[model samples]
Target: MINLHWVILLPIILGTIVKLISIKTAKKIMVLFQSALLISATMIFIEVRKNGTVLENIGGWPDTIGITLRADLLASVMVLLTCFLFLAMIIFVHNKNYADHLFFFLFLSLESLIIGIFLSNDLFNIFVLIEAATLIITVLIMYKKANVAIYDGMMYLLINVVAMSFFLMGLGMLYKKIGVLDFYALETALSQVKDPQSLILPYAFMITAVSLKAALMPLFSWLPKAHGTPSAPSVVSAILSGLYVKTGIYVFLRLQIAFSPLIDTSELFVILGLITAIVGFILALAQKDIKLLLAYSTVSQIGVIMIGINLDNPMAYWGGLYHLMNHAIFKSTLFLTAGMIISEYQTRNLAEINGVFKHMPAVGVATILSILGIIGAPLFNGSISKYLIASGSSGTWIESGLILVNLGTIIVFIKYGQLLFGSSGKKETADSDILEKAVVLTLSMLCFLGGIFGSELIAILFNVKLTVDRLSYSIKILLFIGSIFLGILIYRGLFKKTNRLAFITSFELGFNEICLSITLFFAFMVAYLKLTL
Candidate 1:
């Protein structure tokens, strides 16, 4: 097996070599490199599963003294997913003429950093990885050199830089107190403290950065600009929405686990998650730009995933992880297919382009399947995850809140589903790119299979047996069907005819406002932790 450090380094090494080669040679080398990376990731995952956790210290130093690379089940799964998504992205972009050696270099560098984030066992190392990845992503976002793209890319960079400063401050505070930056060592130190208040400031600072990274509530202003920038390549948007955003969620999980012994933030996050979800869908409903719609939908889905993860139930926690994987599948497909549609139709406006079923049947079918998957249709991957999440909140107001979130999801997608119907005033043609079609259709199929085999998937991915009560599942199905109808009525009656929700689009936040939100969020976290203690 390859050394774990090599897994993080090989991509950048290969990527730089490709930049000096011809474009055609670069593509061939990339395919080979990605295949090798995927193989290595699979082996690493299997090894982790069989042996429990794998740890490697740099330069043979002790775990507490050296920067360590750790691969537990969560890290392995994330690494595996990152490699798989990168492969899909390369395949999706193969036929496009614009993808060059420099593009491949930056893309591969981002891949390496993302994998590094997943494997790093030191908080400072993870922080450095995140900052590097941000700069690379900004470059990719502005690759086309358009004015608007540059503006949005810079905005994204500035926001993250501000957020990372908070992360660095928190890291320094923790190190000052404990004299160690390693995750394991820091967790051990934090656990020994009797008073939670001592660490509350550091927790607030770090979690504020995390909240922004995760795009929760007011902090989400950066996401639509980053993910939906018209000048950014669709593959860039796909990778950003699909795999990159999950890095924050992964860190959130890891950090929360470290603090779990001293403080409980489940109730706080549950409330924040619900609010974020509602706000996400409301803004999504106001979008006309297809990419922006998908971007905002991502914010909503992140909120749903947060709710599931913080429900304080084991089933819900696992369910949230499952949904994270599922979101990557379908959202990537949606963005990839949206790019195809925009290419063919010469527009990004949802109302202006239609008849996808006739103009490009394969793309349309893939898009529809992904939509169904996202909306939690009974036979799709989302249903199983939502079911598990719902099971955790049984007979509570939170349960009803989950239903309301589902209904809002359905309504939001109902507007997006408009793309599949009506004539585009063009002749029908089959989608010709074999590689792109294959990647999209495969993901769409997985959405279906994920639902049907979700119980088994949870067992495989998490090593926990998941049993579903048939009666409860049947009732869930009924609720899903009713929600669909209600969503349709609401969409037609409220969303279709009125400008009531249009004002939501006008509620934009400037950078100063966004920074203020972060300050307030940090203050609130400190207050909450104090009260709970």
Candidate 2:
């Protein structure tokens, strides 16, 4: 039997060893290592799918005393996604001449930490890995060493360190109560507790930290700065927006399950998700920088995913997971393409750079497909996921709220699509190479096929059977079309007329304010759980 734990260890070991070699040699070895890692991750996914969960105890010690690593369906799927994304990122940056051995080393180290987070069954291990990943990401974000990048990296590092302190405090609380750190054991201990309410404080502390990591609502102030730092490389932005943010969501899911027996805060999360979705889009609409626009869009999509997961509906939960993967694909493509466009134009302003179709047809087409997926256009991946989520809605309020969110998303993208047309006579300097084009085209094709075979893909991925309702499908198409028209109208009638609203784009909270928001959010969650549970 293959020790699944080795899957996590191999990358870290190779990353460390690569530091001893020259840059060119390290790049070659890193590529080979990533390829092997992807294969190992795929094998793990297949084994888990065929034979159920895999578990390993470190040093062959007993579960009670030793650390445990486990790979269930969710963890396996996440591992596979992480590996594939890392491979794509490696290829995306391969030709950029930025292949410093240290860069590849840190990149691989970050990859290892991410996989560890997904597979580890111990709370302390998760905390350590998250903290390590945060440090590696800060370094990567400021790799170019520009002034703004340094500030962004510092802010990211500080905020996350504070957040992880809460996580550590919660770990201490859990140990004080349960005497076990393994997740399964913690779950058992939580279930045996005579008064589950006593676990509320630890839960509040831990979840508040996870919420900050996930960039929920007011706690999201750090995400835009980190993801859209002006000096950071585009691939850095892509990875942060695509893979890194999902870590927070993954942690949130795990923490919820670990605490499931003690409390149910799904309703509270659902409400907060709605608020985040609305606020995120509103902020996104006010952004002129293309990357910042996409970053805020990510915040909005994260909100939607949060709502779907917490809705107490299996279909909605599945939809949310699917959307999570879909968002990673499309959003990464957008950021990568945006980086290319920005490079060619030497500017980040969306309104200033027009005629993408004429300048970069392949990239423009890929961008359009991604935008369609994002807006939930018919026969696209977003539409299928949104439909599944909508199918599970029970109340008029839920449906109406979803419609409003969709409208907001559509409006934001409609504004984004402006860059696709209108000729600009200036020639672009940074040409797309074959590898870049291939990556974009491959991702764009997935966006289309993911929608075309949405049900099959869902079944294969999650092993959940779901049937599409013809009537509901037709209605959703109509709604999508209507939303597009409404979005365009709103863009013309309202957005173009608003100059005062740009103040929101410039409005930012400092570290102290963000900490206060975390505290306030924690208090609000504790009160809600006290009342509801």
Candidate 1: regions farther than 4 A off: none
> In candidate 1, what are the lDDT values of residues 1-533, reduced to their tens digit?
55889999999999898878788877877887898899999999988888898999989998888889999999999999999999889988887887988888899999999999999998899999999999999999999999999999999999999999999999888788778888788788888989788888888999999889999987899999999999799999999999899999999998998888887798889889899998899888898899999999999999999999999888788888999999999999999999988888889988898888888888888998999999999879999899898998887788898898889999999999988898879864855688888888988898999988989888887778988889999999999999999999998888776646777788788889888888898888889888888
In model 2, the runs with Cα more than 4 Å from the true position are: 427-430, 497-500
Q: Candidate 2 — worst ten consecutive residues by lDDT sum? A: 424-433
> What would the TM-score be for candidate 1 when compared with the true structure?
0.98
lDDT (Cα, 0-100) at 176 in candidate 2: 96
Best by TM-score: 1
Error of 1 at 302 (Å): 0.7
lDDT of 1 at 150: 96
